[model samples]
Target chain A: MIDIFTKFSGQLFVGLGWTILSSVIALFFSLIIGTVFAIMEVVPSKIARFIGRAYVEILRNIPLLVITMFFYLVIPKYVMKINGFTAGTIGLTLYTSAFIAETIRSGIQSVSGGQMEGARSTGMTYWQAMRYIILPQAFKIVIPPLGNQFVNLVKNSSVLAFVAGFDLMYQANSIASTTFDQINSYLVVGVLYLIITLPLSYYMQYLEKKLA
Target chain B: MSMIEFHDVQKYYGHFHALHDINLEIDEGETVVLIGPSGSGKSTLVRTVNGLETIQKGQLIVNGHDLSDPKTNLNILRSDVGMVFQHFNLYKNKDVLENIMLAPRIVSHIPEEENKKRAMELLEMVGLEKWAHNMPSQISGGQKQRVAIARTLAMRPKLILYDEPTSALDPEMIDDVLQVIKKVTNESGMTSLIVTHEMGFAKEVANRVIFMDQGQIVEDENSASFFEQPKTVRAQQFLSKIISH
Candidate 1:
């Protein structure tokens, strides 16, 4: 691992940078998509609820690799050709969003029972209670789970490697095959992944504490 | 004019009858107390007046809005009605003062400065002026109930419902909550319906006492007359049981 780290430091750092970039982009888009779908699932309208449910069910149940491959292979073949990194990031976002939607929806549904009644009894409309009382508390409740999702998103950025996105895992694969030191190359990349994820996990815990 | 009227109102929770043939009238400025066994529908009946619980049959008119009609805007009707829960249910994220000021600012569209003034006055009325900045969790159960009452009164509701407001309080704390409630009803003269186990508070604060059993009103009488001689056997037994305990 030390030899791999010293010899291919430049290549490894570049891969790590790409990994971080993909993860950041995917995380941002997924949260927005997740929150929108979660709202759709809970709204009083039946059509919106169905569409949200279907979206989540289809995306989360399918294997993430297949989704990425479809975007990479099919989009470039028939439609406008796009790079592997864009395809991989899009795949990661949609896949993670399904799970994020579920997490947020559960948090919204579990907001303390009396909170809604208290607001409504004061003559506030249902939307008013949802906006002022329910959503704020629900956001607090989801912080821990949302943190988990974020960490998972960073790790799942490895999906980029399969699409030749040049993330850490992809670079590790090239270095291991060339140097014939698979164990050291993969181990170095694994440590780099941990460095990114550990801080994210701790940041979430800090946020949870500050809010509480 | 009557503040609330229930004409042959019936309510059910999936085939279990929660209220049966409720026919009652609460005039403006009347203070009524509802007393009953644990599942005798006292809470259910009071909840109906505010459209919190929907009746499957008959009419409920609250502040001149016919709740039985689907077209009636519950939001407008509820502006004139307020409810205090046994659990106190103050918004957990807001400070005590914000809890009182929110509805008036948002629902009633009151001006900001006036809303703050009224909120502070309500906090003072409930004897929690110093605790205005505290969160609901930082306050005691009694203080939270008082805050809940002040929050209700901020909307200038024409009628207020107390659903066993002190049921969740500690024994020593119950008196403080009851006293605040007594003062609110006496001074404001807003039509009030209370569900309570505290017979003494009911006798002192209520002009009328309603006795309910098995989802029906067994006795509805003037508080003094009911206390002097309950006409129904069930009412007498209930009062004696409460008194003996």
Candidate 2:
């Protein structure tokens, strides 16, 4: 195990950097897309709800690897050229966004109907009521579940390994094959994944308490 | 001029008829109190005036805006017509002062400095100035209602609707809320329509009283006459039942 670490430390660090970058990019874009879709699902417009529902359903139902491969293999060949990293990050974003949308939609629904009524009765527009009153309260209610999605996102970035995106899992696989020490290589990667997720969950718990 | 007029209004919640033939007119500066048993369509009637509940059949006009017309902007109408709910419905995310200041600044686009000043004055009027920074959950139920009233007043609406304002407060807290309502209505002299079960409060503040049952108006009379001698047998029985309770 020590020898594997000494030999592959540089490769492992590069993989760790790519994993963090992809997760960060995916997390940011997914949150924005998810919130927009969540709002669409609840908005009074039938067309918007249909579009939002279709987007979430289609993305969430498809396998993550299939979606990534479509972006990697199909899109570059037909429409535009893109690297493995870009394709995997985009895939992670859309996939994670669907779950986030569902989580956030539940949170929005959980907020008392009276909150929207109160804001609307005051003459604020639907969007205004949603922005100032509903969304803030909904976000607070969903922090725990949202945190779960964020952790899942980090773990799922491992899908990048199949596409040669050079994320942590891909590095672990390579190191284990070369060093013939699969157990230690995978164990170390698992611990590193925990390092990202544990703090995130704790931070969410802290946010929930602070808001409460 | 009438502030609110409902002609043969009908409201249905899918198969259930919530309001039946709500023909009513409320003139400017008149304080009317609607009293009825639970599920009597009193709340539905008030909500319709501000376009909160749409009428499927008939003409509903409030502050000269035709609520039945699809072209009519409900947001504009709602700014002129304020509603107070049974549960107070103060914005949970905002503090007492922000609750009052929000609609004015956002809907009316009032200058922030002036809006803040007016909000403070309204809070002072409701005697919640000391609690300006406190969140809605931090306040008592009665205080929340009072803050709600202050929030409504911040818009300086031409007409105000109170849908069972004291219904959610504690027994001891009801009086304070009723007092504030009385004071605001009397001083502002705005067209006030209140739905309440407090017969005494109704008798004190209302010039007219409307009695409703099973989604229909059973009696519409001057407060004094209605309280003294409810004309309809249904109204009399309802009054007697309430009095006994």
Candidate 3:
């Protein structure tokens, strides 16, 4: 393990950087996508609700690797040419967004129905009630579950390895292949993931406590 | 002019009729209390005035807006009509001041400074000026209901509806909330429709009391006369049972 760190430190760091970058990009885009779809699911319009439900159901049921492969192999052949990293990030975002949408929709539903009625009886338009009263409360209810999704998303970025996206798992594969130190290589990457996830878990716990 | 008019209004939940031929009119500044046994449709009738509950038939007009018409903007009507719920549904996320200020600022576009000033005045009226920064969860049940009333008053609505506002509070907390309600309603002379089992508060604050039974009005009379000599057999029985309890 010591030899692997010293000899291939530069490559390891590069992989770490790519992994963090992809995770950040995926997290930002997925949260926005998820929230929008979650609202769509609950809005009064049946058609919008149908679209939101369909999107979550379809994306959630599919394997993450299959989604990445479609972006990598299928999209370039037909519509536009994109790199392995782009494909992996897009797939990660879409996959994670479905779970986030479900989490947030449940949060929105768990809020007392009387909150909406109270806001509405004060003469707020439906959307205004949703924006000011419902969403703020819903987000608080969803934080812990949302944190779990974020951590899972970071772990699932390992799907990038299959598509040569050069994330940490991709680097671990390459280092292990070259050095024949598979156990040590994978172990180092595992530690790097722990570094990203443990703080996130503790931060979520802190937030829940603060909000409570 | 009448503040609210329900002409042969009908409402149904599937096959179960919630309100039946609710032909009633409330004059401006009139305070009416509605009392009934559980499932008697007093709440359903009050809810229709602001279009929180839709009617299936007949003309329901409030503040000159015909709620039976689809084109009528319920939001505009609601801006002039405020409702207090059985649960004292203050915005749990907001402090007392914010809860009071939010509708006036958002719905009516009241200036922020003016909104704050008016909200503080309302908090003072409810005897909760010291609790302006407290969240709803931090307050006692009576305090929460008072804050809820202050929130409704901050909108300066022409009409107010109280739907069992104190039923959820403890016995000891009930009188404080009732006192705050009586002060606001009496001082403002706002038209009000209240649904409650507190016959004493009804006698004290209501000019007229309406009794509902199984989705229809059974009795409508002056509070003094009704309390002394309830006309209907149902009303007499209900009075005796409630008074005994």
Please state the CAPRI-style docking class of candidate 3: high
TM-score order, best first, reads 2, 3, 1
DockQ of each: 0.77, 0.84, 0.87
Residue A1, candidate 1: alpha-carbon lDDT = 83
**TM-score of the second chain for every model:** 0.99, 0.98, 0.98
For candidate 2, write residues B104-223 as lDDT tens digits: 998999999999999998989888899999999899999999999999989999999999999888999999999999998899889999999999899999999999999999899999
lDDT tens per residue, model 3, B35-58: 999999998999888888889999
DockQ, structure candidate 1 = 0.77
Clash pairs, candidate 3, are none
lDDT of 1 by residue, A98-166 (tens): 999999999989987799889989999988998899888888999999999999999999999999999
Reference contacts preserved by each model: 0.73, 0.75, 0.90
Q: What does candidate 1's lDDT look like per residue over B1-245, in tens digits? A: 99888999899999899999989998999999999899999999988888888899999989999999989998898889999999999999899999999999999999999999999999999899999999998999999999999999999999999999989999999999999999999999899999999999999999999999999999999999999999999998998999999
The TM-scores, one per candidate, come to 0.93, 0.98, 0.98
Scoring model 2 with DockQ, what do you get?
0.84
Question: Would you list the clashing residue pairs of candidate 2?
Answer: none
